[model samples]
Target: MSTIAKEIESTMELNPGIPIKVLQDLIQKKYQVHISLKKIFRAKVLATKKVQSDFTTQYLLLRDYCAELLRSNRDTTVTIEVEREFNPTTESRQFKRIYICYGCLKVGFKQRGGEVLGLDGCFMKGPFPRQILTAVGVYGNNGIYPVAFAIVEAESSSSWTWFLQCLGNDLDLNIRSNFTFLSDRKKGIIPAIKKVYPSIEHRYCPRHIHENMKIKWRSNMFKNMLWKAGGQSVMDYSTMYDMAANGIEGGIPESWVDEVYWLSTWKKVNENTIDPINGKEMWTPSACPTSLLPPEHHTQIGRPKKARKKSVEELSQKINTGGKMTRKGKAVTCQVCKQKGHNKRGCKERGPSTSTQPTSQQQ
Candidate 1:
């Protein structure tokens, strides 16, 4: 019994679990013991179930060691395989198909007519450290559809280029005509895309440009002005440009103007315009206000008014009467809704109550 416990502990140290059937099989094979497999399996199951109550201390130490090793070797891959003594064929088949489906779903495939590709990377957690996940999408019918993704490291220009090149090789995007590439203003993305597909129209997302604008201009007025400028049509560029330029003249910072100009120019180049500032000939909605795009895409053209507190008298009246004053200075109750002048709880439409008490004890 002590030998079996020691063996079980050693096996668990390596693999965490040994099914009762597996322990019984090992005992029979190695010791040539004559014991009913069913009885042995039941006894082992009961014993191990008991041990689980105290397994936390051992498991936590093992988990901590595994975590430390993972941190030390951030670039390593580990694969694990388990051999079960008793296999359930149906469950195994189901799990196999589920795994295959997971892979297929991760690598999305669809019928996108033309292959104008865009790529971006995000971080994820796994056995590997700093897993940079790359997403592949196509621009068609004026929309983007993500098709494939991969986990990678570092979002350097070289890393980005390699990822795209590998994708192109696998997907055969060379034949697509005038593929337009769009991404954030990452230093490497533009150069990488230019090198790989020179003919590809490279455009920086206006949303990213808008974010840069916010960083450049802390003032809400200037930020709003920039947004309006980015959304204006090409024909309206002069108007939008002058509006932005005038805004700078009217206390909008010069740095903000320069940032807007840079974004406008980038948008122009991406849209294949000869001159972005010419305003009259090349104006489009895409050329207008830069702030119209982004993390906050709403158009905020006017200055933000400071929120003022209600007058003391007004607040006092509100609390005392549950009434509000309209623009015309008329006080009204929301009492039916507890609004001014009416109480909803005492509305007359609910029928009169019935009397159940005797009338003054029949006096």
Candidate 2:
């Protein structure tokens, strides 16, 4: 009975909206034991209490968690801002906004990540709701490299400014001339970015711009013009942008023609035979390796190091030659419906409809 109760509780914890009757039916089918609706309801209540208690425990331990992060990772920067109201009866501080960025990420970003950064915020879901803001960049492999994250009580100008300020300090944004930012124009992000990164190139995401455009003008030609303008250099962007801005039946806003969204602005910086990692111009032709074995494993007695390390792009090209066999399987097609996924045994289509004429007995 206790084991049965535990199963119901676990299910309810995963899906709080599960119906009590469904739990009753599931228990009967799976365990061959009938469970009353009252028992299922009681189990759900216990699970809810357990989940809430867990959240409370973690909330109380947040300070210790922040301390552990700094202690384990040296040079890590963490800032916690709290709203406090003094009460005569109870004298203690209440925690509020929390922001954390580990040191390893800062060091890694400086070493290997791209200069462009994307900023966005998402509303966190739970009993205690708040907004989570993130700063992300691309690495050599085109993967997202997270720089920092912050949890704020709301998404206002003050919150955004504070988040950006912390991020800028960690990333050393003062001297980042080549850096560019891409983001959807959230309520306060524009002002915050301008204040924090005065000279940095800030571009609105083209997807968001298109979405807003569709709300007013539903012209396919206008959208094509926007895409074409986004792909041109700064010089051509002006001509294409002006044509789209004026040529559209309902004119696009002048602010949308800003050069920040032009293809040249967001284009990836080319190394151009100069190794970005080592800051050296690479003019020499790459020598093909004579042996597959490492130098240390070679029987030769000369110096072990002769060739320069291969770039990630060079390694990826060599790796692509090694191929894997595709899975061997027979094709499946439903005889009844001629579909690929399912067989005729489980096809959902109803059989041919019965004749609409009444039987002779009725006549």
Counting clashing residue pairs in each candidate, in order, gives 34, 0
Which parts of model 2 are misplaced by more than 4 Å? 1-37, 87-92, 112-114, 174-179, 216-225, 233-363
lDDT of each residue in 107-131, candidate 2, tens digit only = 7666554578888887654445567
In model 2, residue pairs whose N, Cα or C atoms come closer than 3 Å (at least 3 residues apart or on different chains), thus clashing, are none
- Measured by TM-score, the strongest candidate is 2
Model 1's TM-score against the true structure: 0.33
Q: What are the C-alpha RMSDs, in order, of all predicted structures?
A: 24.5, 20.8
lDDT of 1 by residue, 7-59 (tens): 55545443334566777777778889865666665555555554553443332
- Model 1 ranges with Cα > 4 A deviation: 1-110, 114-116, 136-144, 175-177, 221-363
lDDT of 1 at 10: 48
* C-alpha lDDT of residue 322 in model 2: 45
Q: Please, what is the whole-model Cα lDDT of each candidate in the order they appear?
A: 0.46, 0.65
Best by lDDT: 2
